[model samples]
Target: MQYRWGSAWGGQRLLGTENIEVAIINRGRPLRSVVLEIRGRSPNGLPPVRMFQEIEELPRNREVRFELASYEMPDEIEELNLSIVSSTAVE
Candidate 1:
């Protein structure tokens, strides 16, 4: 199955800023749920924060925006994109 992510606001602001709005999409198989883990390392020597979102009953080609507890991805990270389906075991 093919999957990808999209975002509206994908960066940090001054302070007390909100994270980027992201969406997860399954291009091939019919998915039931998805757990997205958003992590980032800051240049200010800040540790990475792992955030998660649960997507339920996702149809093919449909997308869901991830709600991260922390801020958007860092600027120093080597990459920024939707994570591949790590595990998509169907029920």
Candidate 2:
């Protein structure tokens, strides 16, 4: 299945350190094997890892809340990367 990351349905930015909730919206056939991981880079470095989680099958076009992370405002996360390794991939 294909994976999409966002704060909501199709959001790219999660302003400030305010408990950001991310969802992995899936669209495609049922996935047999799915491995996904997200890493964020900030000026202060990894901040205690408030939340981190993953899932296997997410309904087509539906969003599955991956996890939540609390970040401080003006933190300006340098990078937010997601890598999904599965039977089907679109990247």
C-alpha TM-scores of all predictions? 0.55, 0.49
The digit string of per-residue lDDT tens for model 2 on 11-89 reads: 5665644545555666665543556656666767656222234565555677666544443323545556666644544
| Candidate 2 backbone clash number | 2
Instruction: Give each model's clash number.
Output: 1, 2
What pairs collide in candidate 1? 9-20
Candidate 1 least-lDDT 10 residues: 1-10
Residue pairs of candidate 2 with colliding backbone atoms: 17-71, 17-72
| Full-model lDDT, candidate 2 | 0.52
| lDDT for 56 (candidate 1) | 68
